[model samples]
Target chain A: MTATNSFFHPAFFYIALAMVLPFIRGRFYYWRWLLLVPSVVAIISVISMDHGTYMVIPWLGHDLILGRVDRLSIVFAHVFAIMSLIGFIYGFHLKEKAHHIAATLYVGGSFGCVFAGDYLTLFVFWELMSMASVFLVWLRRNPVSTRAGFRYFFFHAVGGLLLLAGLLYRYYAVGTFAFTAVDPSNAQFYDYLIMAGFCVNTATIPLHAWLSDAYPEATVAGAVFMCAFTTKTAVYVLARGFSGFYILAVMGTLTAIYGVLYASIENNARRILSYHIISQVGYMVAGIGIGTLMTVNGAVAHAYAHILYKGLLFMGAGCLLYAAGTANLDKLGGLVGRIPLVMIGYMVGAVSISGMPFFNGFISKTMTIAGAAHAHYTWLAIGLEVAAVGTFLSVGIKLPYFAFWSKPIYKGELRPIPINMYIAMGIASGLCILQGVYPNVLYNLLPYPAEAMKYHPYTAWHLVQSFMLLSFTGLGFYFMRTVIAPHPGRNLDFDVLYRLIVNTFAFIICKPLAWMDNIWTNVYRIFGMRGLLGLGTGTKWFDLKGIDLVVDGTAYTVGDIGGVSAKAQTGRLQDYLAWTVIVALCVFAIVWWL
Target chain B: MRNWLGDWLEKTRIKHAKIWMGVFITIMAALVIFNLFIRPHHVEFGYDAYCGFWAVFGLGVCLLMVFVMKKIVQPFLAGPEDSYDSNE
Candidate 1:
């Protein structure tokens, strides 16, 4: 096949269409028809590509491979394409052309990063994702979102720089720019740096605060797109490159536990779900770290499942934010009867995330735990199980109970949500259930051969164990509902460290530097200007007296000598001859003496 | 019909909560009983195969987490929601 036919990268279509969206007049008509064109075309293009590298262009004396149509890239690209469609559906009612353009660019960036076969191409698209997604946060047009968007951009930029440095160093060391797996046992410093960059994007501990900090502050429709990409792309890269790395397994387990612990106390609905994203991605990371065929398959499968349900959850929260104007649980309650469809949709997502039986989470989450056990990582497996219980307690039970079923806290009129939003939620909700019931629907798309995964999620013991665990968790929540109740406050996170560093920077710039500048100005006034004035006066005196005295004295001496000579020369020739003879005698005597 | 369905749903809301709790308790009991009869394919981990082990583990961890988070952790971590907003 020709290069043009075989090498069509999906990202170009969205980017080109995004440029065209601004000029199309008539908001509703334009969006309803043309908004889905890029995603649809991308999906069609993805379906047609065969398994080989395409779009090879020489860049900076190196070959840049833009289309790597392998099984792994294809799986991630598939979900990204479908999720962009869902995102378009959810935000179809928006009249802002800027929002659609930003969303399209963000989606395009994700697709580009996933298909990139070279580190240079991946880094380019990685930054593109970062720059594009920040607009989603800024487009909210609130002071809070504006500030949060800057912080989000700042963190991602730092991550992108780290990746760029690593890629350059690795190129110098290995003499290639190919994106491939780093063997952790034999990795050099550049490999670790690259892994650190990937970890920040994955929202690992201590590097994770940017996610919960910015996601809740994003626009209602924008959060849906933000939820689907970024972290999952990091997971894809981690699974591809850093599998079998032991540190990821340990950190991923800690992230899972820490995420749910914070989600338990968090009051904002979107923030709670944001933390859960960290928790869910932890499973994928740990599974990749385990590095068995089964575990890797589990990780890949989980990412696919997570995108569906997490998008649904965020859409549900967006619905509440759209209708009730606030996502804080302390201020929201008794919304079930008011918006039954949203409640049901939210519950499906809640159950799926909590790993309840007959849901997608049950299928994917169990595989990771089983993989951990099968690999003899007993402590890691146990930690994940505890996190599972905590997950059910906080997100599955507490968040929804307070948001939908608890006593009425909000007394204002709820706004009417658009119908297209409901359709989007319905579509996501159906996928969550469909994949939950039929695991093969998702399993067949795994990078590993289907028969290699010898795990079954539908066994009687597995069902009984999962059900018992979730039920007991529900009972625990029922007993301690008041203790776990949402309050009007924020819980400290790693963002405390982020805030401390930022505040110290501001203090240095604002307070101490200003004080130093003030002192410098005063010193300049007291000594510098006064000293300069004194030097000027002294120079004026010296110029008038010191140099003038020497010149005037010389002139006076010459004038006196001239007057005497003039008097001698004027009288007579005889007097002049006598004077000349006397001068010659004086010169001869001086020469003789010397 | 719609009005009747809405009224019915509203009236049964509290009843639904109660019945849901009962059903949850019963399901827990049934699972604990079923664990006594069924054997897992993998017994490499002994505690996981025990009856009511998961139930106890799940309940214990959840209750401990809630208690520690609310009583111990939140007091240390809790601040006004706008605490960071002032810095911004």
Candidate 2:
């Protein structure tokens, strides 16, 4: 129970701090084994019997309470730790200290945020997480990345401001900053404000546009880090703060549907995966929105499962980017033959995201669907199911088809991927399979007190349904294969409207304003009317022709000033005394005049 | 047996391939109605009959969607790898 005896405690502080050690003082080993420390501690913590929140240090301004290591936080923390390790391994050969530092800080910040018992402590670390992660996106060293990182920061900054405002209001009202339940139905204004802050990071609907736009632009490794934290932490916040906010269900369902549609049209392999991040989070948000213990548990479970597979998928795409110099699906055909390992890794990740049987996504997604069905929100469940199908279509079928099987646009130029990259992906692929096959590994960590989800991967009906669906889809693909010419091109969506149309509108408005100013200046010149300038410069205004002449005449006379100057110029000590006496007499005389 | 099963699968796959979207849409619509009307009222739609029904229906819908996308939709939407980028 003591922090010293418990290895699973925020012992992550040293480990996370150590993750930054490599980047702080650039040495070779910083990037290698330092990544594993957080993961090791996270695993130990998950298995440990620590309950109730405990601060890392009670006295410091930075009080990180490793409070309440229950089922939910454990699940999230566990996955985050594993993801940090996998991501580190994936970028093992990356020599940049910035990349390592950003990853460590980002993951470490998330860890601190999740374990904090108080909202004040969480906000401090939450902003840290945002500040730390932006460097990852900027590491791409491209204009696109620079712009994307700014947009990413802009949204998060707004979210942080909203959260702080809410916290301030709550602190004023309740006189306590500890994380506690607040009912949305009769919520203090602060609660709604805080929830809005949480939603920005959660990528809830209208606010979600930044995630898809920004994530794909990060450096290959950067995207992996982006995929791992942020939104999932918001899901954590949702679980903790606004557990049963019903509107979240609507938001989640719409996000799921929207993600799939946009993903369907996307050409970049990484972009497709990024879209699915929103889609999967939608399921989690919806589950949390349902408010049932089982459903909220499902959201927690899904967030845990999603981090792993989504990270894996991003890693696979990164591997493709590393080897072939492109992740554009059109240009990346028959890569399966070249980088079979990466292809396999991508397939595992794709299957997992697709909710294929014996995959991590299947176990997690079914729980959400079941929770909805249990709640008798059949329509929401149906939307989830439809979105699930869309998920498979956009990622499972489309990614593999274009990347591995489609006719090679890069037919002769394929290259082998790096060994470290393959090994990293291999580890992730194994974990995905293992978690899918035996989901109890993941299920045990849910915030719920005990394990309740029983996944039946094989029933007669289940197999039949799965087979019928897969086989028919396969049939459809082959029949229409001739018609579907696989090629890569940009398909504009909501982000494009902002980037192109809205920007153009700003330009147009500014141009007219500029022209109007020009016209106004011309009119002034035409009339010879420079009123302000004329007044100041003695053209024909108050300074030269009006009140200034009278005011100056009344204020002073040159003769009065000359008399004082002559007295001050006498240098002899006696003369100086006499001059001083005269000045003193003048001072008394002026006082009498006043 | 493997060959026979494979042959049957190929035959079935090809025959059902073109209309998979239509079939999927129909099943999804039916499931929606089932969940909305029959299940909500606690009508005996069978023992948790629709419980995993969506999964089955989803599989069909998913496969058909990919098919329609890859075959019909993609051709119009997808262009040459760098077709739009004239300079490239």
Candidate 3:
């Protein structure tokens, strides 16, 4: 047998680039293009691979498939690779080799997970993703970011453990570690545990605080990468495995409302974006749980469109942070004059996410809401529409309006944004529009391509509804501007709850353990050591007095036998000749008798 | 081209800001009028078939979100931004 194109898994390209990056030490300035190579290569690789498992390894009586190439994984990996390429280009001006490496590994880890056909491989890559993202957060190298990184890591640690526990128990019960779809009706505790793990990454409410906590604190470029991967990858897994889980459906809707509400109150621009990620991901999550073919297809298609536009949004936010030295909406205003190109780029993202007609989000988000409504999930659909309204209010209008057009224009020194950053944002914006103008580009790649094709977003009603909806949302923002204007403070989230739990755990576990240790020390010092010494002495005595005598007797007997043999061997030559003669005569007599 | 656009945004747009606002209002009014002529492909819920249902819903939801979140929830959740840092 000969090797085929099976080695062309995109994960391999990303990880290999991560490994080779550190060696390109000083010339990183000119050689920065290397950062773009793996992603470009991955895009090509994802496109060329046919619909079959490509890289398979035999492991402990199961086939650990590394490349489960099908419509589902293909759609995700396709977008992931493209986003990674864009992320690198957006971060191109940074001289930090570590950032690129971490971002690459993070991207690689996501790809590994998307293609992993078994639980073990998925967990490994999932963990790799978690740690690499922590580094992305930590690369900012400030006290706040350090604290945020630790929190991010700690949350993921809990999530990874949940995934590990779930997968292990599942393997024990089912005798297989395959990462296939779960029948929601037959889902066990372990399945929910796995979903809980995915939920943490997906920014599902109550498990979602870590995202808004961490993303805003990450390095500018890192946030761009962070936004694109962590939650959406989790969405992929949920759509793959836990589709139709009612819990996800409820939680997703709540998250949609929850995220936008918090975003509406957020002072930090990046944090606002972070919260809106929850809102957008909520749409996908709800679609997954709705479980109809159209809804599922809607979820997958939304993820594809989301990666491009959201990455652009992050890049725009990053460019501001990179040049203006602040992402706080309170500090930002009238930046359109300083960075008009960025404003334009960001508006494209804003409009796209707001579900404006002919933008990518319209192509995907409406489908999910419509699918829910059509499926008679009236409340969920209504909840989703409310989220849509909030989305446009906060992100589409508020973030940009404050950052670029608000009164009292910032008089701070502005640095020139790297040309590459603009170029990358441009690329992502183009893709968002391209996918929007030609909806078929994204629709045909969905899991249910036929349903996707059958669903028309360009109907007269949809267009009218979208324009009116978005426009009124603008009007609402205008009316409520002073009420919703971002104030300079932190609004509490589940991170506060997490901190409470951790503090309570410390108090509950530590004081008792310390008391126990004190008691144990007192008990040991007084009696335990003496008891141990007495037992040791008895064993020593028994070994010396009881067991040694028999051994000594055997030695004496052996010595006596040696002495007798020595005495007998004193005149050896004559005795030896006599013994030989006797033996020979005995043999001859026996032979004659025979 | 970039500088020209930047100058326009800084100088010209702010001067004609009211015009832009008026333009936006015009677009909104036109949407409600158009909703009178075009019917929904399918109505899935109450009032969805009526003109201006979306407009009402959109405005209402946005207002409710701000009032609830900003007016109600923010007081409870808001803190000095460095609450965590100080706690740390």
The top-ranked prediction according to TM-score is 3
Q: What is the TM-score of each candidate against the true structure?
A: 0.86, 0.75, 0.89
User: Per-residue lDDT of A134-164 in model 2, one digit per residue for the tens?
Assistant: 8888798865566566657656866887887
**Clash-forming residue pairs, model 1:** none
lDDT of 2 by residue, B5-41 (tens): 4355445444665587677656645544444443322
Candidate 1 residue spans exceeding 4 A from truth: A1-7, A451-453, A502-594, B1-8
lDDT of 3 at A172: 64
Kindly list the per-residue Cα lDDT of model 1 for residues A1-594, writing each as its tens digit.
345576468899989888888777773465556888888888787777778878888855678888888889988988888888889999999988898898988898899889888887888788778878988998999877766776686678668767867876787788788999988889999998899899989998878988998999999999999999999999999988899999999999899999999998899999999999998888888888888888888888889889999999999999999999999999998777777778888989999998887888888899888888899988988989988998888779898889888897467788988999989998888888998898887787789856434678999989888988898898889889989988888787886786566555545545554455456445545665665878656655664575545444444333322222323322432343345446534543453354
- TM-score for model 3? 0.89
Model 3, range A1-594, lDDT digits (tens) per residue?
Answer: 134564488888889988998877564387688888898899888888787776779864568888787899999999998898889988888888899899999999999999998887898799889989999998998877876776687688778878877876787688777898999889999998999999999989899988998999999999999999989899999988999987888899999999998999999999999999999999999999999999999889888888888899988998889888989999989889889999999999999999998899999999999999988999999999999999999889999999999887889999899898999989999998998899999998999898889999999999999999999988888998888778999988887777666666555655555565456445545665665878656655654564444444333333322222323322442253346446534543453354
- Candidate 3 residues lying further than 4 Å off, grouped into runs, are A1-7, A26-28, A521-594
